[model samples]
Target: MTAETNEVKQTTKGADAVDEAIAQGIDFDGSPIPPAKLELYHKVMALEANRQRSGVSNTMRSRIVRIGAKHIPQAELDKMLIDAGFAPLKDKEAAFFYGGK
Candidate 1:
């Protein structure tokens, strides 16, 4: 794999490694890192912080569904939602009106 992908995978898998890499001033690639990539990394770190703060288990799925019934004729999304502890949309209108709420 490329260094960028390796860096991203390592960052995701090991926080300590990411910190060590940062402390060592190791760049993901030979090029200078862009501000946008740093911003995205910070956002991911913030998300991790928020996840810890909320005491929300990462294994628990959110009780929000986005797929409308009409768009998904097989009802697979509904079944998945129900299995994930989310209420299925009863109708297309209701699904569209409150989808993701």
Candidate 2:
């Protein structure tokens, strides 16, 4: 805390918001504002927060699963992909993901 930098904008008070978050075992990375303390918005924010914290890209397997679960027929799936700018795998099977993983 002794170390000082140009970037650290000092608050009016000696303490900062980070102090409170740390007290609550939270990590705050400024992003889209949380919707509200309301139950539904809180749930939405929790899901968003988890997704952001994971820092993982959606995988081809997951996408394929989602597509299959939708129960769209093959022809419709093909057209949807095309419309969404997805193309077939260049050298592999004809499945996986929205954008043709």
Candidate 3:
């Protein structure tokens, strides 16, 4: 919450009444994913679902790391992909974002 990067953030617990049911996580119908992971999930899903609509993957990961929450470790990105319904398409991707078991 710095002055420069000020943005409204929604918590999974205490959002507005409209978000009460969803709890502010990435809501895929009724499933609630954490905000950090869910943010990436939405973007990945969107890219896959409508590839022509978004030419963003080339720089998407770098941009996300720059703008996304500082607490979301880079390692979590791959799992976020999996949870969002896919796996990293390349070894470089896996090396960068793979979450250890």
TM-score: which candidate is best? 1
Looking at model 2, report the run of 10 residues with the lowest lDDT sum.
4-13
Clashes found in each candidate (C-alpha, N, C closer than 3 A):
0, 0, 0
> Candidate 3 residues 1-101, lDDT tens each?
55322222232234253344334553524455677776686677778777553445645645454333244555575466456554433565445444352
Clash count (model 2, backbone only): 0
lDDT of 1: 0.55
lDDT of each: 0.55, 0.46, 0.48
lDDT of 1 by residue, 31-85 (tens): 4556677678878988977763433532232323333343454367668767766
Candidate that beats the other on lDDT, 2 or 3, i.e. the better one: 3
Candidate 2's C-alpha lDDT? 0.46
- Per-residue lDDT over 1-101 for candidate 2, one digit per residue giving the tens place of the 0 to 100 score: 33332223332234366554433333344222333434465567679767743322335433653555356655566666556566633322344333353
- The collision pairs in model 1 are none
Clashing pairs in 2: none
Deviation in Å, model 1, residue 51 alpha carbon = 5.9
